[model samples]
Structures are given as structure tokens and as C-alpha cells.
Target: MNDYIIRATAGNGAIRAFAATTKNTVEKARSLHNTSPVATAALGRLLTAAAMMGIMLKGEKDLLTLQIRGDGPLQGMVVSADSNAKVKGYVFNPYVEVPDKYEGKLDVSAAIGHGNLSVIKDIGLKEPYSGQIELISGEIAEDLTYYFAKSEQTPSAIGLGVLIDTDITVMAAGGFIIQLMPDASDEIAEKLEEKINRTPYVTSLLDMGYTPEDILKLILGDFDIEINEKKEVEFYCNCTRERVEKALISLGKEELEKIIEEDKKAQLHCHFCNKEYNFTENDLKEILKNAL
Candidate 1:
């Protein structure tokens, strides 16, 4: 119940919502990638839809990534988020093992088969505004609702989930993202697509303890809400050790002198939080004298 995120607006604003519950930020990313219950329900539904699309960034060092490369056997995933929803990710086969798309469901679109779903963003951009598509149902919320209706043309309705618990942890992660505001009409987008086709699986209403403003008032309860902001999402990982010694001195000086002549000592790990960054051999000769 602590992980948060909420930002609202209803018919009066022609719908623009976002919700989140993220069971302790996907149980701290399934305890830092010990993932399995289907890679913790496919990286906990893309980390609860990148923490509600990272508070729908608008600066404050905005950033959002969300890659998913696919081709099955869980060969993809790489979330990131900021604008205060703080996230992190990893899972290019976190114990890949595909099976159940039936009895008790956990196939995450067959462990993410077909590929692509990149959506960069980066805001203080001098370039960062990428977008890609394809995976219409590798199922990270319908490839982010077809990447927000073809890469941000908006008109969306995403609902991710993540339940897994018979010991594998994360009892319920969360999600919801309902957009439609270009003077939304057409009878309020056909009554929010017939009340999100009759609600229910946002991790089964966060396992019945629903929050994120009660799942946006159970799907915009007759469009009258207008909350706006609440944020407090987590599982952050701003990796450090002085940002991995400035990324090993930006890999210059001949790749830090061939990692001090063939791995004299350099650990590096951080796939978003597997943490491990030990660089000895005098810390690669003081990071190659700060890379010359």
C-alpha cells in the first residue's frame, strides 16, 4: 500500500488518468531479480507500467525508457523511470521458463515473444524522444496500448498486472492509464470503452486492497474525479560508486587500459540493481588518472 502514484482528471477534462499501487515496487523487483514466477510476472508488468509512465514526465530531469526486445524465452526488458516515480529494471531472461498461458495464467504473452516496444523520452531533450512499436501483445499492457495509440497520439487505456505469490512473493503489483483528451467526445470515448470493458484485472484490483485512488474510482466512476498528483513510487536505482566511477571514465583511455591489462580487478554489475561494482588494481589506476 505504500508504493504510490495517482494523477487524475475525468470527463470534465475529457479523461486523463493514471493509477498505481506497485506492491512495494514489485516486491523490490522480486527481491532484486531473483525473479521467476514467470520472471515475476514479466518484470511486474513492466514495473507497473514504468511507474505510471514515470509520472508522465514533464521535466525535473525527466527520463523514461521501457525497452522490451522479445523473440520469446523472456529475452527482453529494460525499464527506467524518473520524473519522480523512480524505477529500475532488468530481465533479459531472469530465469526464463515459459509454460502457463492457461490454468492460473502467467504466460506473459508466452514470455514475450514477438519483439519491439521502445519508448525513450528524456525531456531536456536535444534528441531523446524515441518511439518504436510492433509487439502488440507481448502484453506489457498491449505494448503500452500500441505505444499510446501509435507512439503518443494518445487515446489509450492500459491496465497491467502482476499477482504471483505461492512463495514467489509479490502478491499484487498494479497499473492503469486511461487517456483520451483531444476534446474527448464521441460520447466520452464510448463511455471509456464501456467502462474499460467492465473493469477487474489490474492485478485483480491490487488483490482486492485497491488504492491508487481505488483504481481511479473503479475506472472513472461516471467521470467526475479530478485528483491531479500524489506520487511516491519506488525500486529506484541511480547506480553509483560515483556513478561507476563516471562509467569507468567513459571507457576512454583505451577502455581504461584494457581494464587494467585484462581484468586486474573490475567487477561492474548494476543491471538496474543487481548492484556489484568493485574495481581494484588501484581502482583501475585511479580510473586511468581520471581518464587522462
Candidate 2:
């Protein structure tokens, strides 16, 4: 199924929910970075969550970034998303690997070890809003849940998963986020907590051909559901040769001259998409003129 995200409200708008199916998106990341199974699982989960969270911002130009820095083999991961649901990211160690914790599951926690999760939001503010929290489980989901409750002061339940095939490709990837608004009654919150705790793994449901709407329906079945919006999500990077040229100019004339004198050429790589841009002697001279 094509990747998409659905936003909905339940319990008479007292409960807000978001769910997404991101198999294609995750597969694209694996292909771009050539990530190992454990790295794929860790990065895929964060990318899925970032895609959903991207649309949470109120402005079109807003941006959200989710970054995890850990002590394990995976090292760290970063995901950036815009309000349009355009998301991209990279793992610090895409080739990192670890034995599966069990027959069917990748060892994401061990691959991430103990670490910190950082959330940064830029809404054209003088200073972007930032929140940092200790990683709870390095499993992505539990860490995000803790982030919401402690950092954002919102009670939330987040479940994220990525199923990697034996061939090291993504088989299924998806997640769900449910939050309690202030008007939520005690009974309503309690009921939702109970239901979410009992639901099957989100990726397992995706493997069964469940859409984001269906996943939300299963979780909010008893409560009245108001489907708010639907949007497509994908692995996207907005890097270009023009952007790279401007960056080289930003380094100032002295720096550009040193590059021309020492290296003779520059090869710049975009971490998000792993795209490389090469600038030769002539290209560096052209950029130097523009810098002046």
C-alpha cells in the first residue's frame, strides 16, 4: 500500500490521534542509506513518527526535527520533517548491526543503547522551541511517549514498528500516536489507555493490510471518530547543487581559496539523501567570484 497519514479525533474531540503506514517510505530510506537490519528498524521508526508529527505544526513553513544520540552501534539518527509531510533523515551508522533479540524482532534497544531524544520545532520564531529528554528504551516508541508526558506535559501513547524482511528490506513500517486533550474526562482517558494497551503491534496490523484509518478505527472504535484529514507521506530531501554552491560561498573567500589551493576540488554529500555534489577547479573559481 502507498504510504499515508490520517489525523482523527475521538471522544468528542477530547482525544487526538494520528496514524501512518510508511512501508514505501522506509524502504526508500533503506535503499538510500543501505542500512543494516537493526539500523533500518531504528531509523524507520523515527522517520515514521516524524512524518506524523510534521503535520502537527500550525504553519506551512514550520519544521520539526527528531534526533536521537545513543551510545550503541547505531550511534545516532536524525529526522527532519516539514508541515507538508515531506520528511527525510539519516542514521549516523547506517551499516551498524546487532543480532536479533528474538526470532522475529530486531534488537533496536541494544543497537541504540542509552541516549537522549531531542525535539526541535521552528515556527519562524526568534528561537525555535526545543525539548530534550532521556531515552526511555531506545525503542523509539517508549522514548517518544516519555517525551510527550514529561517534556510536552501531554499524556500520550505512541507505538512504532518496522518489520524487516530476511533479505534486509523493509516488510512493514507504521505507527500510531494518541494524545489526551485537557477536556478529556477521566473515564475517557482511562478507557483509551486500556484499549491502546491491548491493541496488537501497529506494524503487525499494517502487515495484515490495515490502512492508517483502519488502525485508528480499531483503537477508537468505541468512541466517536471524526476523520480530520488525510495526507501522503514520503521520504524526501530538498537538497540541490544550487544549495551546495551557496554553502561553499558562505565559508568566505579565505576558506574557498584554501579549498582551491589544497584540495583542488570539493565533494559535498547530503546526509539526508546521500547525494553527492562535486565541484572542480573551475567550479570553485566560479563560486569564489560569486562570494566576492
Candidate 3:
């Protein structure tokens, strides 16, 4: 698979690890959103993390959403994923630009500024699980590491990166999520941390022709690592015209009447995919007839 995730365990199940290569998935999002380089990096990082986290869900229909609401130029981002690794997301200000912190690196922290990261998981339950954390760092990876440690009480190391080409297209994008399972020993955890500290940036490894499997091997090669599952992930949105029609219907009879009277037609846009659904006057009238 071109873009895929690998799930593995090591240290006799004392550690759980997930690695993914999401260049194509992120490129599709860049083309769809026309995101600037900084915006692309930030969104790509979150999308990659979301894909890995989504796969952690047990149920086929389980959903995960990662949202960052910040005070910087890139106002916020919202990414949603399913257990099967289908993910979609959007940035509030795709064109927002910021100066690089260094000569080459994109300043994702500046783009995101201070923010709150919210993780919402909708499993097959009456109410979805939600957790919120003040972002320790606006860099998507660190914030998520903090999220895992604080909210889930799982010590995790997350590394995410997005490399932008000269022409403003995605060159490489991917990440790894390493967690210390409850049974993990201090020696194993320390060794894993040391390995991560010595490891190169995920994008650098990916650009050097490393696959997800290779990444895990490099990080946990000595831990008796065993691969459990592998799955392809994509930038997918499940929005349809029928679903859009249902949304319009939910706008209420009076609201639909007002829209019909004023505009003579209606146009709705899907935030996740930038798809526009248009309804002519007749279409609006027909929809109004079915309004609740």
C-alpha cells in the first residue's frame, strides 16, 4: 500500500507501537484545501496522528476526532477518522502564513500558537468519550504526547513531520506513536525513550526511503517486535448529496421557507471535502415539503 499503518508490539506486550506513511493522504488534502506550507505541515501532522489513533478503536464504526483551537494565524484544525483508517480534516485558515523559526523548518508552533487539544472518541456507546488538554506545545506531535500522558494516562512518544517541496507540495508526511503499556518495565521505557531520542526525524527517515515497517524495526528492533496488523489509510470524507439534503432538512421548516423566499435556491458546502451541493428552487420546495 502506498499509504499505510503498521501496528506492532514488543517487550512481551509491554509496548504498543504504530507507524504510518501518509504522504499521499496528506497531498490529497493539500490539493483540496490549497493550504499554505505552514498550514500544510500542521494539518498533515494532525492527520497522520489521527489515522494512527483511529486504528486503535476496536469497533468498525468507532470514530475519532482531533481538534485544535488556537489563537494564532492558523486559527484551528479539525480532523476526524474511523477505525478503518479513513480520515478527513480541515484548517480554519489554510492560507495563514508565518515566518520560519529557523532557516528551513516550518514554525508549526507559531502557526498554531496557544491552543486546546480535544480528543473525542465516539465508540458504540450512548455518549462519546472526550478529553481536553492545554497544548504543551503547538507542534502537533508534542501536544498529542501530552494528551496521551495527561488524558489517557499512557506514556507515549509521538513524532510527526511534513516536508514541503519547493513548489509547495507535500514531499513526505508520516509519524510514529509509541506507548508504554501498563505492564512495561522502567528499563524498557527508558530504552525506548533513548532510542527515540537517537532516531532521526520521521520525515527525514521517510525521505531516506524508509517504510513504516522499517521505522518500527529501527526503533524497537531489539524488543522482540511482532507485527499484528497493517492497513491502508486515506483522506476520505463520507459526505453525500443525500446527507447534505438531510442537513438542509434539519435547518427547520421556517428557516427553509425563509431561505427559499430570499434566495430562490440553496447551496450547501461540506467542510470536510469542500464539496458544494446546490438545490434549485424546485429542489428546495420539495425538501421543504419533507421538513420536520
Which candidate number has the best lDDT? 3
lDDT of 1 at 255: 78
TM-score of 1: 0.37
Give the Cα error of residue 227 in candidate 1, in Å: 30
Preferred candidate (TM-score higher): 1 or 2? 2
Give the per-residue lDDT digits (tens) of candidate 1, residues 230-291. 98888888777998888888879897888788888898898988989898989889879867
Candidate 3, residues 1-292: lDDT per residue as tens digits?
4899999999999999999999999999999999999999999999999999999999999999999999999999999999999999999999999999898799999999998999999998999999999988899899999999999999998989899999999999999999999989999999989998999988789779788899999999999999999999999999999999999988899999999999999989999889899999999999999774
lDDT of 2 at 74: 93
Candidate 3 TM-score versus the reference? 0.98
Position 262, candidate 2: lDDT: 98
lDDT of 2 at 187: 99
User: Alpha-carbon error at 276 in model 2, in Å?
Assistant: 0.5
Name model 3 segments beyond 4 Å from true: none
lDDT to native, each model? 0.86, 0.93, 0.94
Lowest lDDT block of 10, candidate 2:
202-211
Off by over 4 Å in 1: 1-28, 33-46, 51-120, 123-160, 170-176, 181-183, 205-245, 248-271
